[model samples]
Target: MSLYNPNRVNPQRPKRIALVIANPATSSSTGWPVGFWWSEVTHPYYVLTEAGYEVTFFSPDGGACVADALSDPNDASGYSRHDLISQGFLHTPELLARIANTTPVQDLVSADYDALLVAGGQAPMFNFANAHALQQQFAAFHAAGKVVAALCHGVALLAFTQTTTGEYLASGKTITGFSNQEEDQADQAAWHYGWLPSGQSIMPWRIETRLQEIGANFVHAGAWQSYAVRDGNLITGQQNFSGEATARLMIEALGR
Candidate 1:
């Protein structure tokens, strides 16, 4: 019997990973520019690429992407000062250029990739909530027996995604997203501290509540900690804090 060679890299047929990001949208509550969380994309992109996987970035509307102000490691607010992973990733000219330019997800065929990772930001609250086309892409990956991962606010899309069988993706599955308590705290602080507008919820709806409405077994690890869960090919991380951990879990599921 031959032992499996985990280190064997198939240079001729390298696996492909699809990184899904949301197109630019304004925060309805604060009118601030919104895009993706820097770490949510950079951290995972770094992990998967370092593991020798050929990764492609995409967005529903296509074109370049932006980072949420709070998620930018170099932002003046210093909100993400602790996010050195993203800071390091940003310093790489090649990777930084990739984020500055992304292909349209609509241009990709589902079968070309072995996995899909949806990145998070304040934008997903608007884009993913009712994105029928995006739901199809997420469901197709699951139906094809591929590893599919989403962390933080990106997981909000799962609340609206349904399998081909017409069941919600998170229905009867264990998952996590940016929690309601965390949202409340962040919103309150941003308001009280003048980081954003005051007196309204940052989002019109909550991720935790939406998942529960669809009967998801939602799990939380409290504020600002790494917590990720894997159920078969489905992987989810709790929040921005769980980005790299979630990517590793997805990589493990991909058997890489």
Candidate 2:
């Protein structure tokens, strides 16, 4: 007969990652349906999981989540037709179910995971920045010295998040996100294709501008380039294309 020890540590336990995605929303600036970007979530999820980390999906408001239309490979626009990773994720039942219904951020406990990642898309611009519960969870992960990462517009949360001392989390930290140039290009394409009103931008606010305003040392590469920044335990990707790079940086920070 053997007695089980409740407090025994399992050395073989896999590292867990909490991936926070934005819930569906109608973009006020463009009146367009917005949600998490396909590549932003799929790419990082692929990378992290391939590295043997257990990944869980979460959102500010849980339930079902949608992807930005243009980010879908099956979208008529063919905007993301080349995104095979996203396409595969969409086709896989288990992977697709991860985003179908997500755990609400309010239900998350920072101590339960080894790292936290926020995937970006247009919806984040409208929701993530103002979501108090999500911000607190992000801050909690940072305070716990866990790797905290964000991509594209997901970085919006970093601009408003605060440290325990009440200072902006990004203050003096080097970070990158969807840049003004990228936003301008996207808006121009939207207008040219009649998807956006003439003379209107697709986003209510720009991540780069807001982060710079908050005292973050914002840097970026050319538009659509794969660029990621690692400032201590904080990691950020420049745009959708930088997802894998960001995940790799997070893995590095985790010493895995």
> What C-alpha lDDT do the candidate models reach, one value each?
0.84, 0.88
Candidate RMSDs in order:
3.9, 4.5
Which residue pairs collide in model 1, if any? none
Candidate 2 residue runs with Cα over 4 Å from true position? 1-11
What are the per-residue Cα lDDT tens digits for candidate 2 across 31-92? Answer: 77889899999999888777777788999999899998889999998989999999889889
Candidates in order, TM-scores: namely: 0.92, 0.94
- Candidate 1, superposed: residue stretches over 4 Å from native: 1-8, 196-198
* Weakest ten-residue segment in model 2 by summed lDDT: 1-10
Model 1 over residues 1-256: C-alpha lDDT tens digits? Answer: 1123354387666678899888888877777788899888878876777777778888877788888888887888898998888889878897777777888776778878899999899899888766677789888889888899998999988978998788998898998889988998988997898877787778878999989988998899898788899988999988988888998897788765
User: How close to the true structure is residue 65 of candidate 1, measured as C-alpha lDDT?
Assistant: 86
